[model samples]
Target: MFRRFALAGFAAALLFLSTTPVVAAGLDAASINDAAAPPTRLPDRQQLSPSIARLEILLDRAHFSPGEIDGKFGENAQKALAAFAEANGLSFDKAVTADLWTRLVAASEGAAVVTYTIVDADVKGPFLNKVPVKMESMKDLPALNYTSPREALAEKFHMSEALLQALNPGQKFDKPGDSIAVANVLDTEKPAPVARIEVDKTRQTLRTFDAAGKLIAFYPATVGSTEKPTPSGTLKVTAINKNPTYHYNPKYKFKGVKSKRPFTIKPGPNNPVGVVWINLSGEGYGIHGTGNPGKISKAESHGCVRLTNWDALRVAAGVAKGTPVAFVESSR
Candidate 1:
């Protein structure tokens, strides 16, 4: 399930490690293409762009997740289609056609878009005005909640907030009495337990595969920066924590911190680690969720890899304590 929005965000870049250079100079502008999922050579979307989005949603529901389902037949969708085709005993490089359409429709259970009621709970509660950039400054907040109700709802339905807003221009997302339409794509299929996770720092993407080396899930990520580069070797997932409180040690000397002492950031979906923290064996490194889904693969992190909260949860849920997590420079 997607995360719900709430107030009380404790901004954190994790306790820093200045042995490396200070690397969190967030970029000013980011493009959609900045978020590259693993690409495939397979032919895509013979139809219109919306048709491509629908096909992506179908692929997602049928257990092959294509990153964010943004309705673009970009790299991620092509990869997902190729994976699905190969799994179903069809040629992986074939173009989109009637045969593929028949298979997808048969595998899919519902429409790609459906009407959803925005309940009071989904829009309820105190919301955070904004998440703080420095964890050291937060002394009173209880938890790191979502920055807005729109974010909470978007996570609930697995769509970007901007895309959700575009789908319903006049609806008030923050209020209780709004019925809206949203992407019906949900990753409910239990994937084969993930055998390994590859973190491509160059491409800023994470790919998960089963024992047979079939790609099952893909996500755009913001890996470590130049100053705080992620470990350049293989690691393993040490632990998984839901609603993990972030403890920031002041010794690392992260940028913009006036405090000289350590602090603890409360746990919530908007926390630096977002909803779930998949801890890696590498020292102070792992894959976790992020507050800004849009900036994923575009922004730089202190040293950890970051994905959207929902995507992280989807991948984390399927992994185990000993799952291999490899950090490598982009192969593509």
Candidate 2:
């Protein structure tokens, strides 16, 4: 009976494999030698240019959530892809290959695209406007930070890196600053609410809530590691400092920094924390920026909620000193 069951399972597997459609066209040695051979178009119905806008949408649909889908794929996109791949049992190669595309399509099948229209009330000012606009290509944006080459284009446009990958579906972004067009626009008025963070040591996630207690953002975060765990208690924001200078004291070396190291670093993105610093009520512990935004939710920190510079900035602007910050093991 066991042998029969095994045979049946093998047969089913073979049938499934056989039913899987083969999409790649045959390319012979002659085709490889023929310089006149036309380029192979991607499987998608539309011909998407290698722009950041397209990449941003793709990454967004894949549930990587590259923050804002600005266009230029960057460090955030790469981080999102790595996390997505890990969760999906795929290799974190950063390259969006045919296999990755298939998985993304499967993952984004039920995903919803919320539309937003620009309103007079939504427009902050000349410098900041929540306008309903569209772009032909993500290449129109300026250069992006290239920590992860796979998602460099997305970063350049100040867009969400994960969304770019999802929009492109099966296409790979090997080159830096690749351009792509984004067809969708913010056609309605549905603004995303402010982010409220709830640190949970047990689940290892920073749950973001809105004014109504509705969970809007959820990010995996590296609280204090096992050896130097994060302090368990409630804390509140004391102050928000932008472009903060890090006073690196050797005595407080969580990562074994020698005493001879520099005492302080100038305010810049490369500082110990990235660009923003939110001082918590705790003397030494606080939610601050990180030099390595990609490792925000992955690696352990000294004893703080380390967020990406952009993420930290958003959180800082959304909350105040009196805003309640709860540090709990779990929601329950």
TM-score of each: 0.74, 0.49
The prediction achieving the highest TM-score against the true structure is 1
Model 1 vs. true fold: TM: 0.74
Summing lDDT over every window of 10 consecutive residues in candidate 1, give the lowest-scoring window: 24-33
For model 1, the superposed segments whose C-alpha errors exceed 4 Å read: 1-49, 62-66, 72-107, 174-177
RMSD of 2: 16.5
User: What tens digits encode model 2's per-residue C-alpha lDDT throughout 1-332?
Assistant: 00111000000011113333221222111111121211233233122123333344444544344544433334454555555666567885546655655575554332122222223322222221121122112113221123443333443333344443433444355433333322232212232454456888765556556788865444445577765678777787788888876666555655555445445555544456667788878767777765455565557888878765655655676677766667888642
> How far is 332's C-alpha from truth in model 1 (Å)?
2.2
Best by lDDT: 1
Q: Where does candidate 2 have its weakest 10-residue lDDT segment?
A: 1-10
What's the true lDDT of residue 135 in model 1? 68
Across residues 16-108, which tens digit of lDDT does each residue of candidate 1 receive?
244422212221012111212223333233211345556666776775666665545666666667667766778755367556667876785
Per-residue lDDT, model 2, residue 101, is 53
Residue 23 shift from truth in candidate 1, angstroms: 36
